[model samples]
Target: MSSAFEVRGGNRLQGEIVPQGAKNEALQIISAVMLTPEKVTISNIPDIVDVNLLIELLGDAGVRINRVSRDVCEFQADNIDLDYLQGPEFKKKSGRLRGSVMIAGPLLARFGKAFIPKPGGDKIGRRRLDTHIIGFERLGAKFIYDSDDNFFRLETNGLKGTYMLLDEPSVTGTANILMAAVMAEGTTTIYNAACEPYLQQLCRMLTRMGAKIQGIGSNMLIIEGVKYLGGCEHTMLPDMIEIGSFIGLAAMTQSEITIKNAGVEHLGIIPEKFRQLGINLEIRGNDIYIPSQETYEIQTFLDGSILTVSDHPWPGFTPDLLSIVLVVATQAKGSVMIHQKMFESRLFFVDKLIDMGAQIVLCDPHRAVVIGLGRQHALRGITMSSPDIRAGVSLLIAALSAEGKSTIQNIDQIDRGYQYIDERLRKLGADIRRV
Candidate 1:
């Protein structure tokens, strides 16, 4: 596949861009489709690599999939081929995506048996499967790990709901347990649950499909098991991470861009976090209007200490956007310490930015100190490889604001999440070409 983004920097991009459907939400929502045999119609699904791969994996598992439109599709899992899941081919196919682990939840909940390969995704850091495994075990599922094949077999005669306080509010883990608990024998209370908008959207979609869930936007969730789940239509929210990236892009490139249908209410601490960087944002009736910034300054704390941005669970800054935040800070007028608590390797990409003439100190695996250039120093763009989804876009943003042409290879990493990112950026008058 063609996979390099050639970017011409120093363009004052202008126009309105609508964020694509959320990638994380699509993964969780599509996995939940397997819980019911009825047709589940979903709208606003992003045409990204990972989502498409998950859809293809579902099709290979004998789930009926229909493409209603570019942004709409229907999925039905009435005829899952269980034997195929046990074969070597299943492991080879399902191992391609981390989202594939989510299928185990519905399969175990519905059929009482599931075989899943060890999932594959960006190697940003060690993304623990303990949360998923222990959560399933807590829901009364018997799990077997085959170290030889690196596969997992989960079986249960019946799932019995119980209290499960997650070690961390893992978004995918919460979605998996929520799917399993919805059809269990009794009520399940999940504390310290991931309450991100993605999980909230998943819970809302499950509710529309006749599942009982309380605490839509809190760390604690109460789910009462139900026997049957019917089909329902669910629409994914706009990709908030992409929106945050776009906001960073506009600020770094001094562009005037308006983000449409931004779902402003659901952006928990995102806009506030951006405001902390002194990047001005105006919300006009569900749209975010970012004017071309001449001088965006970073903020300091109350005691006049330098501000520090860090990632936490939901209601805190999302770790996914910290890369974008780090990129945006490169051009701000002040200094900020970026503490990426979730993923260790995520902050390592700052070396690439430093190579482009940005002042950055790679303090450690999880932290970086960036002293903004204040538009006085123009970054000279160079070739780089995208390390992961977020970092790829972060580099792309840096390239867009830099002084010369930049070539970002391994753009497949970026494609995994962002939908036709080059095309989307071009719509905003960005001179980016996918070569």
Candidate 2:
């Protein structure tokens, strides 16, 4: 069924909503589960398309899956069919979700070989797999990209510990290599590794499962290979990106909403970045309480230059939030520049916001200059298609603030990341329906 959101704007939402499990964390943790033969139970899994598809892909490979609850599941990968990787259905399933490639790390670590199709997810930009394969090759694994079959083949009689300096702190790449390095013999050192909350949680869980890892929150990691790993239960943190989106939604709609269990400590620099846009986000305990506001003025830099919100590595602003920030800036009291340094095509969605009466200048592919309307002018509803997951939610926020009904199509992109977003918003008094 094709799904679209019918949003009736100009309603002030009010309620408390909890964030779902982090999708990025879930993907890496699920891939790591394939490393051991014992049962690995995980809770707080999001009921979204991408995660569900990855679960299905794992099941197709002969892993025993039990749905303990809507947000809980257990997996036992003791009897995986290695030959399944070469099958057509495997390729078809793996190609649709990018997380499928992460399984190669575990397969290579435990089974001595892996064959994975060139995976796919969002078309945000050129997300390379070089770091993952390079780390593997450095650890005595042989890798070959077969252009003829459009798949990656990896084999290793035994993986040995080695020192690797990643070219960049690629999140998934770092996770893939980390999973593989844990069981490799000797001590493995990875410098310039990604230390996102996702990786930190994964490493913590791996430690509970008996893997020796040093450096929890830093870019440098040391892993002493373990002979075996046992089963352990892990809980994912509430999605920080979703919490940021909700704050933007609350501000845009002038709603008083409390975001519960928001994992505030793990949300580094996100709240501060939102504060730069003059949003009043109060951290009451672990919850984010956003009071209704008519107009929040954007803050200028210390030098009186235009405020610039750009994406950087961990502990800095994220590129994923740039789309939401751009949409929320449309109603602010001042001008701001949004620079998405990671992906070139991410800022192109500003044209759709422009059509809805936003004062925005799309300066090339990577930058956008947004002049605030300061709530003086209301946006009129317009039909638009969602290009990606983050953009899809940004469009939803824009529609909620518009004066009339808006239909946002291609919302499957949104569903792939956010779990039951419409239902959750409705609980917050939003006038949204899925059609």
Candidate 3:
């Protein structure tokens, strides 16, 4: 792929679009596969850049993998070569995805040591790994920050679990600690754990692998460490973020679209968030039907006041989808305050929306006020560049809804998270092409 892409937009996307598996969940699940020395089959893995890159990293680590189908992968972790996993190739691959941080605890638990490089994801803002480090330390792991190498090397003779409380509900931090705790010598109690569906899936996978874990869907978790883990087959849930993004896209373009196989159980607080922007959705069986509601009016609270949409940790609204929410609010009828507390730079993309004729105010690095266009003014298309993954997709939706042709550059950032977005949108009658 090139360093960037040029997208010609301005088409009303329509038709049914099925989202790929959850990229975030897939990453954590794949990393968890390394906990056992048996074959683990993972179905519904998204064939995006991140998953492909992580699979290549796993292959380099000497884990045997085979593609059973387009979205199904069979993984055997019996032969991970430590020497192959410790070099620059590992760092190069691991640094490309934030989920790479999740491998630290699993590798340490399985091999007694691990060298994890700093992870990379969207340049939205500062994502601290302090919670992860502290959690592992409480589980009897010592970390060595290799200042010269820019890697954090963690070692342990044998993991011993203990009771600990998390300062914040960090998703990846909870995943890392959970992986470590599953194989520790004693019982590990984790309080304030993020009880997202992905965490529940991870716990289920661990249980199938013969590890004892309790408190599956709450802030507290008690894990009885086991001697070893076996392998199992699991299917990933649908990507709720993708579903939400598509809902925003359909609303922005005034298109009737259906999102198939969206896991509603994991979609807590999402429909409510979109409802705040007056984007009505119809649920038919497992699919979400978003009709063209061009006359969108932001629904105020019961107190009859302005509404605010803020991103929090898991189970709360996801910070990853805030950019999409902000974009969706621009087309509604009322004003809203979008609070992005997780990342300092996520709200920076509002400038592009502002340039596209959306009324937005950058209150600070973490907050923005969006005044809806009241469906009177259509956004005029213009040349724009993507800065990050979610922002890039948000721009695409804006461009698709714009009146004229718009070109978006740096779309590779968008491709990192979304799989074949142009082709998929084209299938939905979107006039999008990559150049």
List residue ranges in candidate 2 displaced over 4 A: none
* Model 1, CA-based lDDT: 0.92
* TM-score, one value per model: 0.98, 0.99, 0.97
Candidate 1 per-residue C-alpha lDDT over 276-301 given as tens digits, one digit per residue, 9 for 90 to 100: 99999999999999998898999999
lDDT of 3 by residue, 1-435 (tens): 454444445566678999899888888899998899999999999988888888888888889999898799999989989886678878777877777788788898999888777767777777888999999889888998988777898889999989999999887899999998899999999999999888888889889999999999899999999998998999999988899999999888888999988887689999888887888898888899999775788888899988989987777898878999899888888999998888889888888888889999898998899999987788887887888888998888888888777888888788888999888998988877777
Q: Which pairs of residues collide in model 3?
A: none
Clashing pairs in 2: none
How high is the CA lDDT of each candidate model?
0.92, 0.92, 0.86
Cα displacement (Å) at residue 257, model 2: 0.4
Estimate, for each residue in 1-435, the C-alpha lDDT of model 2 and write its tens digit. Answer: 678999999999999999999999999999888999999999999889989998999999999999999899999999999888778889888989988988988888898898777757786888888898899999999988889879989999999999999999999998999999999999999999989998999999999999999998899999999989999999999998999999999999999999999999999999998899999989999999999998899999999999999999897887889999999999999999999998978987888899999999988899999999999998889999998999999999999999999999999999999998999999888899999
What TM-score does candidate 3 reach? 0.97
Local error of candidate 1 at residue 80 (angstroms) = 1.1
User: What does the lDDT come to for candidate 2?
Assistant: 0.92
Looking at model 3, report the run of 10 residues with the lowest lDDT sum. Answer: 1-10
